[model samples]
Target chain A: SQQGEEDPQALSIQEGENATMNCSYKTSINNLQWYRQNSGRGLVHLILIRSNEREKHSGRLRVTLDTSKKSSSLLITASRAADTASYFCATERERGTSYGKLTFGQGTILTVHP
Target chain B: DVKVTQSSRYLVKRTGEKVFLECVQDMDHENMFWYRQDPGLGLRLIYFSYDVKMKEKGDIPEGYSVSREKKERFSLILESASTNQTSMYLCASSPHTGGKNIQYFGAGTRLSVL
Candidate 1:
């Protein structure tokens, strides 16, 4: 079973716009990571935020985690056509024996029009 | 740079046949995982290995089994391939660093069961 669920199953935007996607998980996690997948390819690790941290940034990607609310959000500022892809949030559980194993969310499909 | 490679980019097999998906990583990571991605179901973990010759079952591991004979190689096996088993299989490796659990994925293998 998946631990997280992303909102806005699909999003469409124009170039130079901002794209934001949200993910919510049910269990406590040691860290939450975001991934990007191009069409017909594997997933690329974007960023990882630990439970002790709240927000992280990498290039144009900004991720905020709210442990109290058990949710996280990914923000892509000044999005481009190349940024169009599927975004997924994976949670690393805190209590399980599979410490490093990840449970991914349903993902959000973002399409950026040029 | 870390590189995870899959044995096949696309494969077609008849139903009831045995299937094998191979993954190799060059980063000497301690963790390797197998996941299957579908249209609406997102990515679900099939199995994971923390070390050589050690395996653990994931949420959906009924018909799937994993083999990790070496540190850098992990393989997922399907006992009886079915039409419903047709999906994109992704392999990932992650380093067991301190509080960092980011996974690097291979370019997925698209399997079609006829």
Candidate 2:
């Protein structure tokens, strides 16, 4: 319902398991980015996928964007305890008077059990 | 590597007091942003500056102001800190180049307004 809304507010999984989260936005966007935030720390940039692109891979992270559906998904493969953190999806709206504005979604909190 | 730094890790203030949160980046980024993070609310942009001495309000700019007098530093000011203002404040910077312009964030400042 929000501009950028992520599903599965919290996730708990065993180490080595894959974690997947979904994000949906309302309006058209130029690109979508994923960020990870450890507890009590700043957010770390993960990956970015442009609207025209459907999938992107970075290290153990894989992100997918579906512009026609206005949705995106982030998949963390072989999760570790160190990967336990909150993940957020941000949307960079298409160019206009308010271009370059990055709006974040309510993040998905991932907990990796050691 | 791009690095963004906040002046404080934790700050305690009383209601109605003026508070200043400082952020500096070593990356010489062209755009800087200040955001407040709250549980379930995600990161709400307070203000952003594209260039020195130029600022634009973000989605939630009320009760907060920003200053960008230099290329690497941006400051967020709360004229009258309120209990509702007790949240994690984050600062980020990005080069406004033609690329993805992924943002680098500082370790947030946690402000508790009593």
Candidate 3:
């Protein structure tokens, strides 16, 4: 079974609209990180929010983590066509081996229209 | 900046043939990981290594093996390719400094086993 699962298998929105994606995990985690993948390319690290942090902001992106609910949400403000990509949420368990392996969610595909 | 490079962007191999995927990281990271991505199934970890000459099995390592003879490189091998193994393979590297465990990824290899 997967440790993390994202909501909304797919989403589509116009440019300048805000996009929101949600992720839920099954267990306690040390931190949760979000990544973005352009079509047919490697994933790029977007933002990370530790378990202790409730919310974080970077540029036009906002991430909120609610450990009590074991869920997290990512918000992209004023979205652009370049932001069209697949978004994934990964979780690192509270206790793990030294390697710090992460369990990834199925992902959310967001398409921004011009 | 960290750069994780995959040897091939696309590959094709026949069933029963040996297949190898190579990944190299330029940041001297101590951790390396291999994962396969499929539609709706997400990215499942295949193997990970924390150091040279060390390896560990991940969620789905049944048909894959990894080698880490050097700190900068990691390789995933399929002893005998199978058509079911056709998917996008990704390689990632992360440092073990402060538990942040942010990973850098390589342009995935889309392997088609026929």
Candidate with maximal DockQ = 3
Q: Which stretches of candidate 2 lie over 4 Å from their true place?
A: A97-99
The parts of candidate 3 lying over 4 Å away from their true place are none
Tens-digit per-residue lDDT, B53-79, candidate 3: 999999899888999999999999999
Candidate 2 chain B least-lDDT 10 residues: B94-103
Q: Which CAPRI level is candidate 2?
A: medium
Clashes, model 3: 0
TM-score against native, each model: 0.97, 0.97, 0.98
Which 10 successive residues of model 2 chain A have the least lDDT summed?
Answer: A92-101
**lDDT (Cα, tens digit) per residue for candidate 1, span B33-69:** 9999999999999899999998988889988898999
TM-scores for chain A over all candidates: 0.97, 0.95, 0.97
Model 1, A1-114: lDDT tens digits are 789999989999999999999999999988999999999999999999999999999999999999999999999999999998999999988875654888999999999999
Model 3 chain A poorest 10 in a row by lDDT: A92-101
The residue ranges of model 1 lying beyond 4 angstroms of the native Cα positions read none
What's the i-RMS of each model? 1.0, 1.9, 0.7
